[model samples]
Target: MTRQRYRQLRYPLIALALILGLLAIHQYRLYASPVTAQRVQTVTISNAGFLPNKLSVNKGETVSLMIVNTDIRPHNLVIRELNVQSSDLKPNQSATLQFLAEQEGQFPFISNTPGYPEIGYQGTLIVN
Candidate 1:
């Protein structure tokens, strides 16, 4: 509560935020290529394609999809039927989508980006 103490605390908080931002940027650059780094215990979308087209997960398992737009053009990883999708992804950008596979059976996914014909940009989630 003194003015000087408050100022000192603010400086440390700002410094911590800056350091975290820098670390995140560095990590984004490192894993932006392959999309999934060694530390990512989940799936990755590499080269405009889902690394594992068919994912077999158990029901109620927590699944994380680390999707990166490695393609030059913008794209999206969408599972419309499942009502799960990510915002548009620009090249060299990455986003993590975490969901619980609570149901069993096949779930299809595709690139919901417009103007691009649907190619191999599709995948399935096979929950057991």
Candidate 2:
């Protein structure tokens, strides 16, 4: 091809190459990265304890445990086996615990602070 003709085509080719390169990278990331389905569950804490005493989820899912503290005292929720816990939540406050449910079993969560779990600040997590 003539020099002028080649010059006219060079930038377009470079641009096309760049676009293809970006698309390839995007495709690689889309498939290579692990896919996680985000799950959000809400449990309320009152004088009685966790609103829903029973919680269930499937394996390989990331769970967002949204805790709404609606009691007169502070409470902390924890699932020791799952390595998930929450900070002390004052009355009417809320906290979120995000964790990956990697194992399949029944995990029990209780209040980390004393006198709470025994008083009913507890629940069960069934992972299937």
Candidate 3:
């Protein structure tokens, strides 16, 4: 190859190598960084029922579930695994509950409001 053509090719190859090396270093840094799994999720309650009866989150993450009672009657949200329980959510009222998803499994929730068995309140939280 001509001297000028070889020089031009060599410069481009060197630039490509540098770019690839930088990308690899960046990726390594990202992987080596501390990974703390934390997340927040919102849930709404309406006249019909819970907007999302089932929620999915990553293990070791904390979730903040916002419950907005849009119904006339009171309702409650209970998660046994997280030991979280709330009651007396009157109509147009809102409440917030926090819990950490340390277990990797499915947990159930219920309203626990009396005379609401027929209406039935049930949900699940899945962690993985």
Candidate 3 segments whose C-alpha is farther than 4 A from its true place: 1-39, 115-118
Q: What tens digits encode model 3's per-residue C-alpha lDDT throughout 2-110? A: 9999988998999999999999999999999755435456667777677798999888776778888887888878886679887668888888787677789998877
Show pairs that collide, candidate 3. Answer: none
Error of 1 at 28 (Å): 34
Off by over 4 Å in 1: 1-48, 115-117
Residue range 39-116, candidate 2, lDDT tens digits: 679999999889898998988887878999998988889898878889988999998887778999999999866644
TM-score comparison, 2 vs 3, better candidate:
2
Candidate maximizing TM-score = 2
Q: For candidate 1, lDDT tens digit of each residue in 35-111?
A: 22223334455664877777777777766777877777778788766678877888878888767676888988888
Which residue pairs in model 2 clash with each other? Answer: none
Full-model lDDT, candidate 1: 0.75
Candidate lDDT (C-alpha), each: 0.75, 0.87, 0.78
Candidate with the larger lDDT of 2 and 3: 2
TM-score of 2: 0.70
